[model samples]
Target: MSRRDAEDLEAAPDLIAEGARVLSGADIEGARFEAKIILAHILATKPSRVVINADPLAPDSISRFRELVSKRASRVPLQYVIGTHDFMGLMLACRPGVFVPRPETEVLVETVLGSLRPGRDRPTVADVGCGSGAIAVAIAHHLPGAAVHAVDISADAVRLTAENARRLGLAQSVRVYEGHLLDPLLAAGVADELDAIVANLPYIPSGEIDGLAPEISKHEPREALDGGPDGLMYFRKLVSQIEALPPRRRLVALEVGLGQARQVARLLQSGLECSAIEMRRDHGGIERIVLGFIDSQSH
Candidate 1:
């Protein structure tokens, strides 16, 4: 066969067809896209370019492509191999064991940004359990005057978050620390000074961690997934800490497990009066974010 014929056989459509043969499951469509993305990255091109060129994959490229596809077939996340994910228009670094920043959490960042106005600025903000520094860096990048601090329990997570902040040129604006939810911030003397606290803490019930997608259950850290028996452990602790805060600090934004929105709202209302509650929906319309603000006078 001529080289042109080989190229025709290795075109985008042909590659996708080959991918379909290897991936058979409820998520086959996602698998196909993943395969294309990996192939495009390996070829140093865009997804659109892959469809246009359709050049035959070199023998070396084919072997590497198949290796990635096999992992995708087993539900391994593509972002880990690519080492980056797009969140709120930011290219965030991701790796094995570090929680991949999800699109749903972008709503939380939007809500936090919306709360801050041009002239009225909060002096400090704390991002609890800030995986990859998505929330903290976004906040610092957007609100130049506000002081941003992030804390995570896992040392690796803290390191990854710090790396991301530096990559995004937010290392000077945002501070990343290693400690439990509020420990690091409190130790640094910024706890009570925080005007807003945002957290995307682990909210998956311990029993259900095994049931999550392999991309998450197997690759991501368990400490970032398990949220205790009912998946409210982190929320409970967060609310407790909020109540402990001084009167000057009040607003808090949290990302909860799907279907746990109401329960999380109730937990917040138990201690602080909710002046406003906005539920930010994911692409599927599920409530993915829960924002609450305490009345200034009450606190």
Candidate 2:
């Protein structure tokens, strides 16, 4: 082994302590926690075990752990560094190009699931802009009878969604497609037959994107974050598209930014011909989800 690697292995505790100090200096919250997580990732063990064992690392593991700590210290998101995230009680694989699923978005999934009638068999649903397939896979996992079609504009997102579905054993139930919102569903011949449509589309205003944390503004995909000047660009387009399509009985659930729920609810009511609309809040009391329903026979 190289001289530096040999030295690092011998002083593993000192090395971990130093890594945590560096992260703390960079203002990274939970610096020690992140340090252990990075070390455990390299050691192929749990973070809890890492703390309890106090074992020295191998030369290679020390070197790799140092590299990851440095990356995290630079404000790289921990999820991206670890290459995974948890959403709706499901572990999802994440990558740089795809948007990481946030905890608030889970409310959107729950809203959609709650709207489903109990004991319904094989209800058809569509997920628009299905980044990382978090919502799509979670819906299919929780509602085994759901036939879910997930579509995304980015090929990377499409592939990631498919991968998550396959890993979660939802491949048979969730189909991932590459295209703009709703287009893939139309092509797949399920546009008019859908019982529900859910989307967590880009809702951050273009002007406000620059103010987001570096982990988001610099690392997350812009196409997944920018919602135009007023933060409703994609929502407006989606509502217009639904307006032009033939009417059908469908429940629509969308995740909107804070203070955007009322505006989005209005748009859905007028454009989608929804007869009833409801707003659901996240644990933070922020209105995060809007649900609209249209009767099967109503225009």
Q: If scored against the real structure, what TM-score would every candidate get? A: 0.88, 0.93
Native-referenced Cα lDDT, model 2: 0.87
Model 2 clash pairs are none
lDDT (C-alpha) at residue 226 in model 2: 97
Candidate 2 residue runs with Cα over 4 Å from true position: 1-8, 14-16
Report the lDDT tens digits of candidate 1 across residue range 90-195.
7788888789898888888888888765334755889999888888988888887778899998888889888988999888888988998898877888897788
CA lDDT of 24 in candidate 2?
99
Query: Per-model C-alpha lDDT, please?
Result: 0.80, 0.87
lDDT of 2 by residue, 1-299 (tens): 78977776666666667778989998998898888888777777778777633665787776787888989888888888888887977889998999999999888888888888664567898899999999999999988888999999999999999999999999999998999888878887888888888999999999999898888999999999999999999999988877766777778889999899999999999887788999999999998999988876653
RMSD of each: 3.3, 2.1
Candidate 1 similarity to native, TM-score: 0.88
